[model samples]
Target chain A: MKIIITVVGNDKVGIVAAVSQKLSELQVNIIDMSQTLMHGSFTMMLMGELNAEADFASIKKELSTVGEQIGVSIHVENQELFDAMQNI
Target chain B: METKQIRDTIAMIDEQHLDIRTITMGISLLDCIDSDSHKACEKIYDKITRCAENLVPVAEELENEYGVPIVNKRITVTPISLIAAAATDTDSYVEYAVTMERAAASLGVDLIGGFSALVQKGYQSGDRKLIASIPDALMATSRVCSSVNVGSTKTGINMDAVAEVGEMVKALADKSPLKCMNFVAFANAVEDNPFMAGGFHGVGEADCVINVGISGPGVVKRALEKVRGKSFDIVSETIKKTAFKVTRIGQLIGTQASERLNVPFGIVDLSLAPTPAPGDSVAEILEEIGLESVGAPGTTAGLAMLNDAVKKGGIMACEHVGGLSGAFIPVSEDAGMIKAAENGNLNIEKLEAMTAVCSVGLDMIAVPGKTTASTISAILADEAAIGVINNKTTAIRVIPVPGKDVGEEIDFGGLFGRAPIMRVNQSSPAAFIGRGGHIPAPIHSFKN
Candidate 1:
């Protein structure tokens, strides 16, 4: 299943590198990525595919830990929900 | 993958309180009927437990999978009056309620509906028995909800049933007045409603179906806040777009749940049901749409537009839409409404007027215990009249807290919330209600 991971916090270096590293560690492939700085605050949204072996809950916890280490707020959600709510 | 879409959806859930209100599995209990009451009760219990065994787990799984909060998991069986008609050993239908309660507890459902009777035209033996058992049944069970349809557009109002239910509501209040919260008096009640205490699997519905009720008053309110001071057309358009997003999520959840459970998908009830939590209020939506408060002069017009826009937006998102598809203004369940009522900005009379446009009528209202049963019946009649005249569904679920008077509050706790005992007009409608005969169907209903 595909999921969307969003990170929003102060602009800083290594935010994308850290998130992508965490995703690669879990064997989840980043399918899409977007990031921008708005009024000195950094916002990034990434759509990733979770392989069969990856546990969704653990990935969420580990990513939150990474977010804490980077001083950002991370949210993960199933991609289908966004498609359902926005496409129609 | 649009980042804006992802962020907006997240904001709707995390900030605006967007959630699927209920996923009710409607299980028809018609086949459980038996001549022997004990055997029938056993059959009823066994069938419900078996059919609903995985409802909670499946709903929770969907909640996690979809990343949307499914607030309630409930079961609505065929109206117990119809199922109890075949029982020969017992005249009282309280045991059926007990059986339903047991099934709900075993399955871990939040509430089990259909402890109900449809006596809109008249009463059968089972209907009478079930009506009589309502007070005791509701008082005894914690999770069982009940409803009675005492009027309809086609059949008019069954004044006799209305009169009886008035006394029944009072009796329910007399014994643990909070039990009155579990009972709904309806006019033109629908079968596919997933919201309790009005939900029931109509005899005409399929044996098993999954009906979903979607709630997003906060989302709508937030959208309106963006268009503040904008024209009505802009406001309406914003509401429609927001409702579309909300209902689409509901369709997704409902379809997935039905597929997983192997039950046919029922309709999605696009009701903007409110919660006691701030920012999750239908009345606040109205206020955002330029009303000073919910019960202010323009409230009805605001609610009417909101209700219509929601339906127009939701109809395109779901395959089927049923139940009371409009903004609900239950005082106790809505923080804005409760605040308005406490401050004397909203009252029962204005609420009665609002029901002509709102989805349901006089819902979750608390009245003084000293209020007479006849007065409660009169209130029901008034609300039913609005539904019948307008050809819409309206209902009453008022509680008359025992030994509590106006200005006092009854705390039901949790989702039921707290309600202040609002004053009821002391005028008597006993003469009209005492004349127990059917109120003839309106002229519009005669379009044959």
Candidate 2:
């Protein structure tokens, strides 16, 4: 299963390190990634794949906690959610 | 996907109350009919439970998977009158409603509709029985919702049923007025409406199908805010664009749900339904179009424009669009509407005019407990005339809160919301309503 992880907040050190480390710990593999200072806020988009049996809800909960620890907001959703809305 | 678009979607869901309001499974019960009432009741219960067993679980999984809130998982079946026709031994169909309620409870569905009869032109024996049983059925079950088609553009209005329903509604007030909330009298009621208390699986529909209703008045309002002080053109366009995005989400969810349930996908109802929640309100969208409050001057015109723009915007987003696909203005279910009614800015007269331009008519309104049955029937007649003449759908779900006068309110809690007892027209329509017969369908002439 594919997922999209979005992180947005004021710029700070080790934001990517904390997020990626947490994703790796949860057995999520980062297949693609991008980042930018969008609208004066540090924003990152990470596309990842999860195991077939992995739970997205618990993974999302853990990722958000990691984001809170780093003073940022994180949202994780099935990639299909974005595709369904944006593509057509 | 572009990061900007992704961000906008996230903000819409998180802050703007964008969500798929309901994913209703329409299950036809024609084959479940039996000569024996007990056997028929068993078939009704069995088919509903079997078909919708996975509805709540699948919907919950989808919600967690996509992170989009699917607020309700509901079922609409073939109208009980049609299904109960084979059971001639029974005079009341309350057991049918009880069977549906039991199925809903076991399946964990939020609501079950189609405890209804369509008597627009005339009544069948079963239709009369089902209509007679509606009040007791409503009092007997919590999740069961009932609707009766009393008029249509093609068939005209059934004034006899109208008069009877008025007395029936008054009777409901005598015991538990809240049960009145479960019933709707519709004009030109659609076959595939996914909203309660009017949703029923029309005989024309498939054996089983999935239909979704989308709601996001907050999203449209927020979009309009970005184009504030602009002309009606910009306001209309903004609402259309926002409605398109909101409906796309509905289409996606409906498609996925149908595929997973192994049921054919029906249509996405493009109605911008609202809740009592602070930001999610269709009335607020009208207010954003520049009304101080709902029912103020220009409210009906504003609603007309909004309703048109929503259809224009959402028509292309789904495989098919049906149901009551206009902006809904149910008073008890909308925040801005409730405030307006409480503050004297909104009244039943203005609401009646507004219904001409919107989807349902005189919905979720609470009238003074002393309001007469003839007057209630008169309200139904007025709305039926509007629908029949203009070729639109209108429905009435009024509650005559017992012992409550114009200044009082009924807090139904949750999505049922709270409704202020608005004043009703005191002039007795007893003479007119007392004279019961069919109102002939109007001529579609160029003489207008």
Candidate 3:
């Protein structure tokens, strides 16, 4: 299923590198990506499709752990939720 | 759309109090009936546990996947009165309530509703027994919520049942005022209401279905903040836009749960139900609408606009919209309402006026232990009269705190929230209540 991985935190170098490395390691296919910086804070939205055998909860926990170590907050959610709310 | 939708949803959950309030699985227990109450209870237990076994875990999965909080996972069953009517020997529905509680505990569901009876017109066979048993049944079970439908728009007000409910609520309060939170008296109560202390799976509903209720008063209030000082048209339009987004999320969750659980999707109850947290209050939304305070003179007008906008927005977002879908003004459950009540700014009469525009009537209000039973019945009659004439759903959940008087507060804690005992006009309604029978349906009810 498609998912959106959002990373929001104070702007810093290597934030994208850290996230991309984690996703590549987990074999998640990043379909699209967007990033913006405002008021010294960074917001990145990554659209990805998980493999058939992917475990979203564990992947989310792992990514969030990386975010914690790097002083950021990461949210992983099914893209359908956003589609339902905003694209309805 | 430039990721704004994703960002907006994330902010709503993180900052605003957006949530799927309850995913209630409504199960029909009509087939659980048996001549013996024990057998009936056993069947009821099996049916509920089997139907709701995955309710909690499934909701958790949805919460995790969607990155939103599902605050409650509830179950509603056919009114126990109907289920136990075949058990003519059952004097009290306490055993049935106990069974419901056990099933709820076993399934890990938050609360089990449908410990109820529909006596809108008059009492049926098991109706009086169930009504008599409510105090005992509620006190006897931990997670069993109870309600009675005393009147309807078509059936008029059942003054007899309304009077009895007043005594029942007092009796429940006498045992433990906290249990009063589990009971509600209704006028024109719907069958698919997924809310607590009032939800019952109607006979017309399918065997099993998924009904969802949404909460986002904070988000709505935040939206209104942007439109502050704007014209009323802009204010209403902004609210509709926010409500549409909120109810659409509810629709997705309901549909997903139904597909996963193999249950039919019933409806999305689009209510701005508030929590005790400061930011998440329907009253705050009204205050945001420019009311000095919730019980202020212009409050009803504000609530009417909100109620209408929510329904209008929600109707387009989902196929079916039922349940008590409006802005809830429960005194205790809402942070803004609690503050207003504690300061003696919000009175019971004003709340009654507000109820005509909102869904629940005098909800989560606490009165002095000395308040007479007839007074509570009179309050119910007034609210019922509003519902009957206006052709809407109105419910009352009042707690007469034992050994407490006005101004003192009772902390129910958790989702039930807290309430400062509000003064009830002590003039006795005994003569009016004593003239019990039926208050005929309003003239508009004769549309046929």
Best by lDDT: 2
Q: After superposition, how far is residue A6 of candidate 2 from its true place, in Å?
A: 1.5
What shift in Å separates residue B175 of candidate 2 from its native position after superposition?
1.6
lDDT of 3: 0.91
Q: Candidate 1: TM-score?
A: 0.97
| Candidate 1 C-alpha lDDT tens digits along B330-448 | 88999999899898989999999989987988999999988888898989999999999999999999998888888899988988788988989988998988998889999999988
List of clashing residue pairs for candidate 1: none
Cα error of candidate 2 at position A59, Å = 2.9
- TM-scores of the models, in the order given: 0.97, 0.97, 0.99
Worst 10 residues of 1 chain B by lDDT: B59-68
Cα lDDT tens digits, model 2, B176-239, are 8889888999999999999999999999999999999999999998998898789999898888
Report the error of model 2 at residue B131, Å: 1.3
TM-score for the first chain in candidate 2 comes to 0.96
Tens-digit lDDT track for model 3 on B1-448?
3577788899899999899999999999999999999999999989998988888988999999998899999999999888888896768889999999999999888888999999999888999999999888888888999999999989899999989999988888889999999999999999999999899999999999999999999999999999989999999999899999999999999999998888999999999999999899998998999988898889989999998998888889998999999999899999899999988789999999989988878799999999889998999999988998899998899999989998699999888788999988977899999989999988888886
Runs of candidate 2 exceeding 4 Å displacement: A37-41, A51-53, A68-71, B445-448
Q: Which stretches of candidate 1 lie over 4 Å from their true place?
A: A52-54
Q: Retained native contacts per candidate, as fractions?
A: 0.81, 0.61, 0.94
